[model samples]
Target: MTLLFLHLSRSDYKNFLNFMTELSYQCNITLHQSDIFSFLKEETYDLAIIDAFNPCSFLVIEKLGIPFIAFCPGLFINAGRVGIPGPLSYVPEYKSSLTDRMDFFGRLKNTLAFMVSSVIVMKMDALFDQVIDEHFPAGSRPTIADLHLKPELWIYNVDFSIEFSRPLLPNVQWIGGLLTKPAKPVTPELEDFIAESGESGFIVVTLGSMISSLPVEEFLKEMNDGFAKMPQKVIWRYDRSDWPEELNVAHNVQLVDWLSQNDLLGRVFVKHAFGVGTGVPNLSLNHKAFTIEQAKHWCYQTWKKVAPQLSYMSGVRDWVDQRK
Candidate 1:
């Protein structure tokens, strides 16, 4: 029997340390005193599923001696942990901002970052050592690497289409879109608005869940000016309650307090006149937006070129069948 629980203190967000530091701080918590572990000892779970990013979970589950599977919700799992090639050559390091395609300097920077992050992850994983020492006998206590390197499976909740081509072990499963639901027409107002847009299908603009508002007032003005010039109707998810009253609202753009982002995205079937633009928000509170035409032309089209060759949900069924 297995249970997966990840609790992050709301207080952690108050200071908002660097992403790695925050994860490390979370790992600093000891599970030896938790009542949940006492209950875990009594119950019988067939398998444990745990957050791959959290080493403490691995240790707790390992203490139960039940086979466990892990999931890395984000991209950076160094497959090298299992003796597979997670070479710094192609696989990006944490927060490197460099894609798989790299030049000499890019590779050098990535290598440095990879080394640094590996140390950080190692330290984070080690934070649970006291718990392990307390629970397991000194002679039998497993090292951090032993606990980390032996999960039965690693489910990467990642879009394969977006990832750089790289080797994966048999135990590593690439499954995606698990959280995506069928687009719902629950919002009557949005439904009516989309219906009125007709053949010129609407574009959905959102900075996503964490970002409720842009930092600067000028950013709003620029976005307003830019959206006004667009041909297609835009439903931009912004915090309308916090919107500046002095700004002129674009007629083409609909500002809402919040949007059903997945519903909006899944429902829309529109020919995009503009290519994709990504503002790499590196876990920072402030986000800067920019529009560069050359980058838009280069970045989005290359994915289309490579996507056809890739397989979606490959090896997952076989992996499951073998495990069963």
Candidate 2:
């Protein structure tokens, strides 16, 4: 049997490759670099794992006669369908300010509901007959829409072991948090910064890859000022060269052009961290802090969101565990 892994972007492809290597599966696994649907047309596989961020993969896999799994950052079943009027709706507009975006709880709730629903609809559309045979009893028949609307199909969360409390088909499983590889090693100077921070837990601030191009000076200043009052060291990852020198020289801060996030998050003394960037929420902090307690709470919540699957070895490990 062979496993085909379809990835959307270069970074996602790189991350998936790292994950497959660590899984050490002995099957014939091919990494297709281009558009996944185009690649699917040329090959056949026993099973496929697709990144949920890539909706194109869903449309492609639906036509391919193979067992498939879809992975996303958060809930999967309702993802693309819930908030969206239909599958083809345009992407929602988000505010430039992180504070405004995060504070908009209604949007967040709707988006999450949509994601969860999308996952269910996608799986039912893909595995309708198969799931019915194994999960549903002999006398019952389920329609495609019924399968899609059924709340029991969601199988996995980022942490796979925790089963959804509601009724669900056995095939659905939570296997998030399986890709906890350490970030690539940093330069000696970056390593030294962590060392100098000493025993008090430090903070690592990054805005991930997609939104890193946003105005850095203003964002960095807000972060620097916020961390200055806290007792922890702050490690800021900025891509630009024009950072204000005064903040760079602060006793409690270290500013770098870039640093390996996986490596830094794995550090022992980095008790709290905040990230502001694209993709799913991982150590995210909105740019404004009205109070010290709020800042600390944000720091704590950010870690909590990403911390669950840090212990798993692979997506499959978490995936399998969720079945239990």
TM-score per candidate, in order?
0.59, 0.44
Q: Write the per-residue lDDT of candidate 1 for residues 1-324, one digit (tens) a residue.
A: 000001123454223234445554464454545677678878888888987655667767877789989877544344555455667787655445557687899999877776665655565555556666776787888876777678898887655665667787888887656766676774888877778778766767666565677767765666566557655577877888788988878887788878875677643322111222232211111121111211222233344331111111343223223322
Looking at model 2, which ten-residue stretch has the lowest summed lDDT?
Answer: 92-101
Tens digit of lDDT per residue, candidate 2, span 1-324? 001111134574456445434432211112222365457767767777765433334433444546666544342224323221222122222111112123456456435544543443444344334433443357764444432232322333344232122333454565545555646877898777767767765666665554443365564454455456665576866555655556554577776777666666633222122222223333323332111122233333445322332311223223323422
Model-by-model lDDT, in order?
0.56, 0.41
Worst-scoring 10-residue span by lDDT in model 1: 281-290
Error of 2 at 157 (Å): 4.3
TM-score, cand. 1 vs. native: 0.59
Pairs in clash, predicted candidate 1:
1-44, 1-45, 1-46, 2-45
User: Which parts of model 2 have CA positions greater than 4 angstroms off?
Assistant: 1-40, 63-66, 76-157, 160-164, 181-187, 241-251, 266-283, 286-324
